[model samples]
Target chain A: MTTTTTRTSTAGAASTRRTRSSDTPFVTFEQANRRLKWALLAPALGFVGLMIAFPLVFTINLSLTDAFGAVNAGNSYVGLQNFADALTDTRRFWPAVGRTVTFTLGAVVLETVLGLALAMLMRKAFRGMEIVRTILMVPLLATPVAIGILWMLILDPTNGIANHLLGFVGIPPQEFLGSVSQSLPTLMLIDVWQWTPMMTVLLLAGLTTLPEEPEEAARVDGANAWQRFVHIILPMLRTTILTALVLRGVDALKTFDLIYATKGPGGGSDFEAETLNVYAYGLTFDYQEYGLASAVLVLFTLFIVAIVVVLRRRTERSAS
Target chain B: MTHVLRPRAARGIELSRRSFGVLAATSVLAACAGSPRTASPDAPLRVLAINHVWTQAISRYLPELEERIGRRVSLRMLTADQLTSSFNVKLNASATDIDVMTIRPLQDQMMFARNGWIADLTDRVEGDADYRWTDFQDAPRERSITAGAAVSVPVVTERPALYYRKDLLEEFGGAPRTLDDMLDIALETQRRSEGFFGFVGRGQRAGAVTQWSSFLYSFGGDFTVDGRSGIGTPEAVAAYEFYGRLLHDAGPPGATNMSLEQAMPIFAQGKAAMYVDADAIYSNFLDTSISTVTDTVGFAPFPAGQAGSVPHNIPSWSLAVNEFSLLRDDSWEFLRWASSPEMVARLQSEGIPGARQSVWDDPATLASFPADLAEAMRINAANGVGHDRPEVMQVGRARDIVGRPLVSGIVGEDVASVAADADAEFNDFLVRDNRQQEF
Candidate 1:
């Protein structure tokens, strides 16, 4: 017992001496470098913190105020009055929210379905496959504002080629963007055209990474092409599909540029094309209702967060 | 860990280093973008102007104006929408990147003055003996004044007038002399003319307000009385209904989307017998490149309303010194010289409507435009009102309030009820803003 205690004390003393030596001027290059790396990261971390925290806090604070117009240039805090007003605002707020949801859902569903079809089409190797892929990406690369203007010219009721083409088929001219009901749907079609290529590329990558054993096994069992796609390929591509939906959905919910370019302020004529993003922008800049805009943005952010959480959970569950 | 490929690891390290460098450079670029490029006071005087034809004409004379003023002026032009939106942003934040800014006195003078964005040029105008402030047309000069202070220096002035086909009017017996006469002529011309409308003017909401105001005034309705909306009055409602009747019954197809930009070309193309629009677009009508009826187009005063022939003879463009600018004096110098009699004559000759009475009166300059057009301008300028649109800081909101009714009226809605609704909305806006309750 005495010998064992002496050995343990001696071992502890040796470790203590080693630890002290390690902390002194004889510190190794790797240890010193590790400490130095954190010092280097400090500024970047601080910058990112400032970038996020400042706006987050500022927006939250502003959301509680009644800051509107030139007279109320963001001073008097009204304590969730703006939020209450927005929550009950059937006229502007609720309508905008409905449009946002419809636009996002319409765009995402179309993009995902179209993207999958496109992915399936491009999965097999063929001559000029590169060219085909490049063609799909053309609209995505074009400036959104330019696209909007181009579409505007194409949809112009008086002189547009859309009406001209319809006239060829003996159909009456349609007010694609001009009509109150047609504007949002027309914008969704544009969005789908622009973003479907992105989803296709993402899904294509996922397809390439997917193991072919299950599909092959199903094919060997005399399963039809439809059966293999539904039972084997689809089950494997769930994560990729969910990822595409989340990506496309997030962007769709925040659509502003195309709407702004096409419709201008207050979302055209009678606010027909106004979604939450456009509504927020008009309030913030056009009318200078900063507080109300901030409230709307905050609510919009929470909504996005809630949606992403659900999507991410589903993605994780399938992955697991 | 078992077999780390040195070359591959080296490539990975190189890639990350390159990425880090790119990130750092991006950060630097972002920082630079956020910072405004400010010039020293002694540097060229920065004049932010709208990208209008008048401003384009002025751009040609900038070098000469700079030499005469003994200071170089750098002119940066933006579209009308950009100027209105961006200037408000910068001015509201008290940024002095811009020294002189273009303004529509009828639209923005009251707003700018209320916000203390523009310097009050009352004392300065009174002090500058050689500036010839008296030479400016009274209507525009009055419009530039806010709370008895000169906040805007008028440059390009315009008034709405009747433009008609000389051949058509001759065939129809004579020019319209009253609202009733004008409407009858319009109906007859529309019925008689093949593949052409009788009248063309702005019909879009917000856009139609100014053109509609001519009709509104003719019917003996003022915009406001004692800070209450005067649009709901019998005269105003009647005027709106009459306006609706003309457009709904005789104007072009898809007239709901037509503004002066679209309507002017329609008239100039001989598709319409008569057009009522700003004097600035007169040059467009004269430009043979686009106008089909340039030779046949004749100018006349607006047909008499109950208030007699009154059209808005207001400055389409004005220059204001930024109150936040350190170079206010330099900006004022540029403005004064730009709007001076000598410059006005040049500008007028160049086909930009000038604010100077002397420029319009000069026989040489007057000859530049048709004699009938010049006469119309002279007569209208003499009887011009102080403001065209609502005299309020919230001009755009007011226009929309007024425009909604105008649009509804044209579409065959109950104009009386629409006018009442518009009045209520306008009143609510004023009450909320704590501004003057009416236009």
Candidate 2:
């Protein structure tokens, strides 16, 4: 009915416009409508162009130059020497790449598994559910830097609550973030603690959206709870799981604040916890190697894009 | 209804277009009409500084500065790293908002001067007689000059001092005067105390370099000798190994990760027998809230090595005018007032050390400090080197390379081989750094 009314009104408007004199100053109504649509969209398009496109293009251009120290300082174009330098750099670049991958994979995998399990357990409403939900949101609410500091205090080797608790259990004190070997793993745990709740919330929403009929039908067919979940609920939740993976994966790859706050520049003495994001930041701000930093950023951007594209493809496939 | 809606929709579009044009015009007008100049007649003299004791002590007397200059003063303080980041982002774009900046002459003066981010203060500092530019100590005063121009004026100077437990050291015949005695006392103290450490200092790769420089110098070595890498020298290797052995055997379990923020607490809490760090942080040992060994803490000159005690007497912080600032004259006025003889003496009496030699010379100012600490500071200052870290354009990267062997020592690795490797790396970095400077 709405479509019919809109069609009739448009026809009436066209007929009314046709009755006007051909020598009128205004163009046809269709042409004016088209121009008006573009004029309205121009500002938003301009903003996107300025904010996103310009910086990305500028960074790519910078990657090809020998920009150093101040941004406005005189610098000559050095072609792809910066990229070649980064690619060949085993000391910092490769180690940072390895760390970024290790951190993202370890943190995301744990978050997804734990989040899915928690979401399943909490799917049904029970006593004091709201309070439990609120408690789960605490980690998500705190700033990353604040969380990093809190974790550092808790995990301090000599005089921390974590060591105190371990001592009660007859375990020796473990250097969590302090030891170079343990820094990355400790950061992964912190990431898991802070972000698992977000994953649970997302998966819970997905769980709520799942149809109950299929599960009921499987239960009625002599399937157990685990069987019904595996046969029915899991298959249906594939798209949501993949969506959550993409969202969380992208975020995990770009983690900086917590790592920087806890481990500091070059990600501790040995650059043990220095991921790609932190490395790029150190190069750009700390060392003022803008040209080299830009090259690393461009490469990092492409790496993230490639991962996102692969994940998105899987999501679409699961949805189909 | 559709015919009526079409004209209204078109009119809405037309209104939006008109509004956009008006908004665009207003934005252009706003862009052209800049904010009131910070240097203007009645505007505040804006200062960006690090959140240090010097900045804190000076902040209380800002009203005096304002009264003298006949203008309001706006001082904003940030952590050292935060201040550096702010300067890099702001000065890169030639920001005029910051009139005066507290800078690290040794760490960032070269870069800032090279980039022309800081104004040349040679004329203002030298031409004014009462300001007494030469009154500043030789080591710190020499550091203020970048490329033959006085780019910054030293405000706070630092040197390494031995912080020992007075109570613990009495059993070992007081503070050790030599490196060997210090190590022996540290080892004996560690052997007696179950959970306590013998010696604690910075061990982090980059953060440890400045403190380690004193040891390097006393060991008859330097970061560079005649513009070449010096870390592979026998003296340098011995220095690195001795530092590593000191920490690895008698220091805490995670000494490799401890910088000032981590290591200072151990000494303050009476968990370590001997600690060496900047003299600027002596108050941390005396602060009731943070220190448990206030009464027991003792200060001594940096322990003598093969070449005797040669600590780093360097300008830790300084004040400079932003090159792009419109209030350069007013900024100069603030600098001169802050660094003047009377002001430095006043601040020094309150326990904030100043760069002026006259302040150090005054017995009245020395009265505020514990007698031993004052003596230590005096001796260290007289015998200190100008620069602590590697003197290069990329100081951060250079420190990292120079400090790799230090970390190796702390982690109980072979120091000689690591020093050789790091020495090679540092030489390569210096060559590249020199090339960049030429650019």
> What fraction of the correct interface contacts does each predicted structure contain?
0.03, 0.34
lDDT (CA) for every model shown? 0.78, 0.89
Error of 2 at A250 (Å): 0.5
Error of 2 at A287 (Å): 0.9
Over 4 Å off in model 1, which ranges?
Answer: A1-39, A46-52, A66-74, A220-223, B1-42, B68-70, B163-170, B174-177, B181-198, B252-254, B258-274, B288-298, B435-439
RMSD of 2: 4.0
Top of the candidates by lDDT: 2
Model 1, B1-439: lDDT tens per residue?
0111133323222223345567666876786563444556367787899988878888887887677666778889997778887777787667777889999888777766776788989988878888878888788887878888898889888888889988988966667878888888888888522347888787777778877777887788867767778888999899888888887787765455566655777787788888888877787777899988878888888788887987777888899999877777778887887888888898788767888877777778777777788888877777666566777666766776877778776667788888999888887776665543222
**Tens-digit lDDT string for candidate 1 (A1-320):** 01111224656556544753564222223333554565477478758867998778878988888755443353688998888988999977999999999999998999988999999999999999999999999999998889988887787655568888988898887767766668889999999989999999999999999898999999999999999999999999999999888888998898898998877665665567889998888777556667888999999999999999999999999999
lDDT of 2 at A254: 99
DockQ of 1: 0.09
Candidate 1: the clashing residue pairs are B218-B305, B218-B306
Clashes by residue pair, model 2: none
Query: Which candidate has the top score in TM-score?
Result: 2
The list of candidate 2 runs beyond 4 A from truth reads A1-42, B1-39, B191-193
